[model samples]
Target: MASSDHYFYVLQCADNTLYAGYTTDPIRRLAQHNNGTGAKYTRLLKRHPMRMIHLEHFSEKSPAMQAEYAFKQLSKPQKLRYLTEHSSEWLPK
Candidate 1:
């Protein structure tokens, strides 16, 4: 089976709140979110210029989506903690 380079990502929105979702291209997805053409929830928030704070690569869309759902379930503080812990791992190196 071909491996999926799908990624589950977390964004720190303009309002400083976190949002989670899966994508094949986080940079483009984030651009869409900032442009008010992404998720309906984000579109209605009057927020923009979203910043990507976390990213996790998965082998398939299904698992990436599952990770997205699980990440979304985290409380804000918990999410922040996760971000802090994982930040260095995904940074350009």
Candidate 2:
């Protein structure tokens, strides 16, 4: 069976915009985002390198997926504020 641990993440695009997603491997996912091979929204904003600014690990895929959905619903400024307050936990290492 696949490992239960998954991650929901957010990236700060070059344009200072946020993109949220879920994945089993954050390192690879970041690569895809940078390479313009990730989500369509991210691809469109790939003019500026996407930098990982937030990530939350989950023990199950369902919860992580749910978070991703909720994150997508957040307004841009709300997401930015979230990142600001959660900087210590989410900022790139």
Report the number of the highest-lDDT candidate. Answer: 2
Candidate 1: lDDT of 79? 74
Residue 23 C-alpha lDDT in model 2: 97
lDDT (tens digit, per residue) of candidate 1 on 24-75 = 9888899899888999868855567677878889878898999888878888
RMSD of 2: 2.9
Candidate 1 Cα deviation (angstroms), residue 36: 0.8
What's the lDDT for residue 8 in model 2?
91
**lDDT of model 1, residue 39:** 92
Give me candidate 2's TM-score against the actual structure: 0.84
- In model 2, the runs with Cα more than 4 Å from the true position are 89-93
- Model 1 scores a TM of 0.82
Q: Where is model 1 more than 4 Å wrong at Cα?
A: 1-3, 89-93
**How many residue pairs collide in each prediction?**
0, 0
